[model samples]
Target: MASDYYITADNVFEYSRGNSLFDGLNEDQIKTLFSISREITLGKGSYLMHEGDPAREIFLIIEGELEISRYNAKHNQNHVIATLKAGDTVGEVALLDRGSRSASACAVSFCRLRSVSFDDLQDIADKDKSIYSIFYHMSRNIGERLRHSNDVALQAMEKQLDEFKTRVTLGNFFVYIVIMLSLFTFSLDGLKYIMTAGKNSSYITLPLTLAFFVFFIFFIKTSNFPLSTFGLTLANWKKAVREGIVFTIPFAAVIVAVKWVLISSVPHYMGRPLIEGLTAMNADPKTWWMFLVIYILVIAPLQELLSRGGLQGPLEEFLSSKYKVPLAILVSNLLFSTLHLFMSLEIGLLVFIPGVYFGWLYSRTHNLLGVWIAHALVGTVGLSIVGF
Candidate 1:
């Protein structure tokens, strides 16, 4: 659909000015190049080209990112070999030899692309000899990629060896699971009940949260893992938040719709409706402010740190399964839901749905801030506002 998208030569040139492929072209030649190329639009996760496909053209990135990956038959997985961004070129090797593609190109986000075929280059070369300069650049790009590929292959081998050596044993996994569940109960129920004498659950989260925060820092220091291992850093906060919001909105809408159906269809549906709770809290302004502040500041981040950082982070590193990351997320969320069973079965099940979302979001973003924001929004809206 990029053919329908309006784009001028000037726009393409400006966007790709930093790219080495267009290094020395004059204004007219650049215009000719743009005229010969076809624009393309790709939705996130859509493939532009697949490995072993006959290559008819080379592509240029105008905007957004592309993941260059190859399927590994041994692992039965598509291993990402490279990431291409604006001003980068793909499929140059195809132009050189007219061979099948070595790797697949998939969009990481919504993308704007421009592609040119070997025939198009020949047309320009006939008119002007300078077109061959692009070919020269393409050769250099191929050589660079080949070198990079060798390095990546070496790294992959090293990673496989490391995983083989460090893979967690079944007994070790059970120990970890037990330890995590014990810690969750101790923090949420045992310590809270003791400190508050079972009278005040509102102000208890802050102290427990602070204690766990200190414990995590100490544990990280002793364990010799980077803060990033737990998604504690603020790196990629903007993109993380953006992606989290995009992922959460549609799911949130579905949840709201389900809640509406339940309230309308079921008799005496879910005692203490959100509206009545809000009205009662509104009658006491202090209570409303306390609820918001506690959930947002203390509860949301605490839960993320425990479920994602404490449990899922370690599981991802130690698990040796082909689908380790997804397995880690699922296993961690099972424990996440289990910890909430003390509240009620319905609450336990409901938390698992959101727990999985939070886990997946953390996996993609690798930042606690974004996941925390998403958790805060969803919990406040779903539990406090919608009374789900």
Candidate 2:
């Protein structure tokens, strides 16, 4: 297309009458604008503006079509924003902010446009009394474009978020199945413990259980789960202490109640793990202190880290896929309760309350330190009450 595709002065009156920025200007003002504005032509497939170029001019499309597009590194491409036509205004934002161009525009067909540089606009605003009113008009157009751009960006963001959720759901599903398999194995082993009554299997199975816990963490990590996923973090230690103390108060009450009921109601012929485990404490005072220390430190952290942190966190996430928060909590609660199956159904049922409560605390806090401390304190208190 030739440079004179549109004559600058020929349509000055017509453009000023209807064009947004120049509208409402008198004939003298229109003539003055026409004197300074340039007429430019772009051949098909030629760029009119580029992103990051210095903002200098605004354009009034006189004839033919152009397309607006933006580059996104994430998609590794330019996404088309709009297809503009004649009488449509472009580049008004340049006249206002005079910053870098946000998007690129290219002519789709041979095009003619009236262009007014910022310097020309500034000169007109300085000389003419009426030119000051164009700012609001330019701002309104920029706001519209911003809103449109935001809508496009928002749609893209929503799509990305949905994809991320799908990935997380698939991950949780795999982790959930593995944990269930591990629990099933543990339940079977508990039966073996009950049958043999710890006579010959102490050295082999106990060490194996410890090894299983280590492998369980490795297994979870291999699935891309972090320890922090189970709310295990030393970050926000003060908040953890407060939550631990708060959780422990009710926890202590529940522990005392459970222990009281167990002692008063259950008979003493028990050869269950807790009883048998605590019986070893009676060997001597040194052994008793050592057992208490180990219980408070090693056993308590490991158990809560397993059931509440590791098991409950992923299990709840798994159940929450198709269920509500209540059902998710309930399912995890049941799974935690089953850990005591070797003791009795009654004991399993009894522990379920604390399991649910502890899981709830972990969910609310998202830090295991609180629940770990509460679990340790409650376990120690409960064992002491049982004279273990």
Candidate 3:
């Protein structure tokens, strides 16, 4: 719903004084314009107007943000072309051309605006010649928008040309592999503890993992790849988590089935329950709940960042093969599995199977949320609950 208010002459000037749309207007002209203008407040997510609708009024934004977008009927999507902020004027194109709106506008946040109808503007023009200045300013604003659009298009083309010129080569892939292997050396300290029985690896592994994570961040920043390339952003988090859950359910069921087969067919096989495994690793079973929480929140996300985001993302970019995605996933998991060899050959092989799935999921979404969720759940269920 929208609220209407009567804006005083003083309030009107305060709002319109520095606005480009009202430039060169005198005190008397501004006052006359506001006299016929309506002050309206729109809540967030409210549509100001739809594309193809008759545009009879031009609005000056005093506060808040609005998205100007075009709807594609074929795609069933709205592509936001621009975000209008305070001091921006909207719907001026309709006033100039006497046509419908070219784009739809929806308030991004609570908005306060003053709108003047075309009919009222014509009446003002008949009474006073000075009103033509407002139209002139509106035309200038349209020209500025056109120039900005051209500049943005030119920048996009330049970026594509640059990418084509410096396309990643096999040498680039080898360089990246070398860097990752160099970083993997730091984890050997934790591996020694895992290999030695009765020596809890958590104290050693935790700090080592944190150090590796810090170095990973440094490498990513220096390499000039945006964090999004590694799926560290909050974009589409809900969708990412939803896809992760969808992937995880069937994967978890498969793990359970594998556990069932092992228990039923294997002679004298003793399944390692999560509690017993924690105890065997010298972790306090009393704090088992806390460990599960940390595994889900911290441990899972950290490993995903290293394996999928850090390794696989760049591998995909560097590989020119038609099957680059699968190759990247395979190569990344090879390194991922190799790191666990210090623990045990069996453990290393087991880790590769899930690492492949995680890498594939990361490739599809390119967001951490989904892969992180899947990794956390699979790890918890396989090692802790289902007992691999």
Candidate 4:
């Protein structure tokens, strides 16, 4: 087997430029170019450049494929911006403008690349007009390719969006079928069971909740999701927490006002009495302290571990290969919602919407912090009324 290694200057010079923008370079110029360059190898699944990071150097791919992606917030996915094969150069635009990189670059295989710092290349361009021409032409060509790639990506996104609409329609149709069949099979019995279950649910809730937490922890331990995928370390966690609190203050104020208004003005829309029962449970000092301990030490961390850490990580890897954002979101969201079935169908659906949103956020940002914060916030607010 060929030893996969990093890009180096010697191999970079030997590599044929073919019809690339750099193809105009003669052998002598290519050799001269090698003088200022150094080779570096990247293992499969390694990053070359991250979006929004300073573009300090230009990369010439000597082997394997390089994937370029831009984060799409609306879709909550990483959109493929372009792909580069051997002899392709990346970050030329960033080099010219001294701007942050617009896309992230990752090595798809064990690959080699030749890198030249922007400062060094600028010096060469200043002294050698020919080199400057090469740089200008390469930059322009790359820009044109990027624009074309963007157009193609947009078309693909539109197509995918249409497909997503179709899938959602199909999914809803299936759900209706299931609901109808269930109603036909056990109408009165099912209604009675639901009513009885709701009345007696408190006895089972604690055990079910504990089971869910345990399973969540196990899922996290067994999964391969990278904890720091979004550059979220302990330091980032603290920062995110601070930001989360800031965001929640305004959001909570609005929610509280809306809830108060609805409760006071609308008889039919009166809020559920569930919160009152929870509030009473929480008002007991001993119960409140225990609830706090369970949540802070157990529930919050475990759920984050399972949902964001475990589920989202493997889900990203699996979906990345297929490149089907909607399907990935649906599957992951379904799983998230299914785990909450013991709660209530209404609660499950409520959690599902955010589950899909969080999955998308994870795919786009490649970070777990946002979803973790959202999950924790939901639990804290919803559970706080009960006492935790």
Candidate 5:
């Protein structure tokens, strides 16, 4: 039979003695702390708090579960973000801000909650200056919970990444290589393939870009990997940007030194003007910037998506399991650099060093945001140094 007796200070102190709220407190301290609180029972499916409701109280779950949800405007529905159980606390932020609730919460099961109102807290604070210590204790409890939540989120990400790594197949890597080689061979230069095979380039690269995009979708299907396998997520984008900057620094130094030596000597190896014919179709000098924008916004993303996200990703997965990370990084660099072989050895080397840097970075992080940022930085720097 379920025991549904009314709780006393003695029981509250007993039950929560080792709980986070009472953590580091003695029995007397726990009893004194919990003595101010009262208990209430909420029925299953009843709202404990509604989004936009005025915040006046916080609750510590004594028994059962509460489902916390937020309304998503995009979906036109409520998405449950979390569930709170015994020993969990909610609405503490409200007591601090006196702001409205940001989410809806309802009991998932018949719940017993230790209710501590803002008014009650104020009374305790007014009586004794030592009540400031309670606020400190509350902040510590919330801070610890946030830290624990962050740890759990990171672990989940690793688990998801592992699942994606497992889904990668050797076939995906081979197909991308063969398809890309065929396209490169047929075009003689990748530029013509991007052109409309007509008098003007007129952003014809857009449709060719779309075709390359189709190849990525095909890669996902063939590899049996989810689309989530690629790209930096909101959860990890900050880390991606930091890692991208740190990894690219040393590589950028070498790139600058190498290009500085060859740029004046080799006409073919240097100059943003090299791509002007393909990008702008030899349009007016003023129109060069417009075409450059297209190249950066459209072409760079697609190219990285293809080589880094599509090719390097699965190759890393397949090879890393056997030969491990270094071999996978080397092959990805070699393949990326090989694509530039149509130009010249000097040009190829210039591209190769950055390719190696990018390949290694993505191998370690699997974050496409970082890869794209690195690509943009390196490409922009190259264009600037080589002139229009």
Candidate 6:
């Protein structure tokens, strides 16, 4: 009764012809193929194989269409190489050779596929010489198609790469012009301030003047940007808090050790007294509590939310995998350091290093815990010794 089910032989054969390899197979052969194969269904836009993944099995599309794409390094794009309709067999060559997949395959529509593992096919080929011939031919055909696709992709990428280079050159020219204008404005303002105000006025103006310089520097640095977005949102606040605590602990420990070393090594001077006072405050139980509260409740959650939470997800989608982690950490570290600019340069730099470390941890874990523990530990230890 199941054999006499609504799924007919004519339907199977018609589907088989959609694939080039099965083009020559008769209804009996299609039925035999179906007997040996397992059916799989995929939703539209689902991946069958990812680029660089080991090809383990060949897929025969029984219904719908599949899209094949290869990563093109020159254009930094995933180039669509082919559209495969029903009955097409893909990954035969890579499966047979046990090689990395040169192209990725995704379902263009809801797809029904029959998959035959390399081992199963090999067993069949070993038993029947004719089957081996068919298998060999199918593998060769898939290889040829893949080669042709690569060639076309390369040619298209070359053109795109040239266009991209030209655009970058033009963009940089405009950026340089902007930087020049900013420098001119700053120079004029500095001259006017100096002429109108006394030496003490220069000290009073120093912070504001430096702020402008830093703003311009940041603008310039980020002008020719790759992907940099923050994805953390208010919904992720709970997760960020968890991450922040994990990050602060170890980070605080390291900070404590570093501060202790500095206190032991640095000679007593005006700056030393201040540093000593800060270190002493850390030893106080009240100071420890305050430091813990500030780091865990205030700084960790806020910083992670800003750097890793919201728009960062979309920005990361556009970036090359290799550049993503570094960029995230760098941007986060810079923001952290900028927030501490009002503090002493030495203290700011000290905090900046730990901030960078924390950022790296956040990027690597995609969780806030590691960085939070590091931060809290370092802060608690450092402040305790300094008599905070």
* Candidate 5 lDDT for residue 30: 58
Per-residue lDDT over 141-258 for candidate 5, one digit per residue giving the tens place of the 0 to 100 score: 7687678667866887898886675655555657767896687667655564443355333354455556767877776777665554555245467777888777777666665665
Scanning candidate 5 in windows of ten residues, the lowest lDDT window is 272-281
Report the C-alpha displacement of residue 351, candidate 5, in angstroms. Answer: 2.1
User: How do all the candidates rank in terms of TM-score, highest first?
Assistant: 3, 2, 1, 5, 4, 6
Lowest-sum lDDT 10-residue window in model 3: 272-281
Better of 1 and 4 by lDDT: 1
- Model 4 earns a TM-score of 0.42
Q: What TM-score, to 2 decimals, does candidate 5 have?
A: 0.46
| Candidate whose TM-score is highest | 3
Alpha-carbon runs more than 4 Å astray in model 3: 1-190, 200-204, 268-282
lDDT of 6 at 17: 60
Whichever of 3 and 4 has more lDDT, that candidate is: 3
lDDT of 4 by residue, 179-281 (tens): 4335434444543475465543333434444554554444334433334632244545555555555655555454455556666777854664534534634
Give the per-residue lDDT digits (tens) of candidate 1, residues 97-196.
8899989999998888888887888888888988788999999988998899999989989987755544433335455556555677766666545544
Question: What is residue 139's positional error in candidate 2, in angstroms?
Answer: 15
- The better-scoring model by TM-score among 2 and 5 is 2
- Clashing pairs counted in every model: 0, 1, 0, 9, 0, 61
lDDT of 2 by residue, 1-388 (tens): 4334444466668656767766677877778877887878899999999988888888878888989998988979988988888877788766676778888999999888888888878887988768877777778777887898899889989978866765675575566557655866766765566546644222332443465467457646554455676666776767877988886887687655555566666776244343334453344566666666766676667767766666666665545365545565677678667655655686577668767777777777667787778776766665543442
Q: Which window of ten consecutive residues has the lowest lDDT sum in model 6?
A: 225-234
TM-scores of the models, in the order given: 0.51, 0.52, 0.53, 0.42, 0.46, 0.39
- Residue 173 shift from truth in candidate 2, angstroms: 5.0
**Which of candidates 1 and 4 reaches a greater TM-score?**
1
- Higher TM-score: candidate 3 or 6? 3
Q: What is the lDDT of residue 56 in candidate 3?
A: 92
Q: What stretches of model 2 exceed 4 Å from their correct place?
A: 1-169, 172-176, 179-183, 186-191, 194-212, 223-227, 261-283, 315-327
Worst 10 residues of 2 by lDDT: 200-209
Candidate 5, residue 324: lDDT: 60
